[model samples]
Target: MELTNYLGLAAILFAIGSATVLLRRNSIVVFMGIELMLNATNLVLVTFARMHGDITGQLLAFFVMVVAAAEVVVGLAIIITIFRARRSASVDDVNLLQS
Candidate 1:
């Protein structure tokens, strides 16, 4: 696929993910949205790597995948803890950290 097509798809996915993050109240939905955005970025990185016949993008994508994995693990743990503490998954209800 062409770079523009790859980038455009990435942009669209990023937008949808952003909208999900902004419009949703559930913590799990927000986490899914973040994953969606990361996957979209990963696709674009791989596409660019293929287009340029270089491994740099692939390496970056690999690292990104690792980070994303770690993020999900930690993020889910935090969310779960928060949910247990507050008994609500809605973002507005958990505001103990807010000043």
Candidate 2:
């Protein structure tokens, strides 16, 4: 794939993720949006690595994916805990520390 095409797709994905984060009220959806943004960044990194014929960017993307997986696990766990406590996934309802 051309570097420009890859970057364009990354940009589109990032935009969609941003929209999801802004328009979705559910905590889980917002978390997924964050994941989407991460994936978009990884795509850009890998594409640039390919364009430059270098392995460093690809390696960095791999590490990023690994960290993203860990983040998803931890994020989902936290979301579940919050859902249990609030009985809803809406972000607007979360204000436990402020109370």
Instruction: List clashing residue pairs in candidate 1.
Output: none
Give the per-residue lDDT of model 2 (tens digit) for 10-79.
Answer: 9999999999999999999999899999999999999889989999999999999999999989999999
lDDT of 1: 0.90
State the C-alpha lDDT per candidate. 0.90, 0.92
Q: Write the per-residue lDDT of candidate 1 for residues 1-99, one digit (tens) a residue.
A: 457898899989988999999999998998899999998999889888988999999999999999999999999999999888878989888777868
- Candidate 2 lDDT at 57 equals 91
Q: Which pairs of residues collide in candidate 2?
A: none
Every model's TM-score = 0.89, 0.90
Global fold similarity of model 2 (TM-score): 0.90
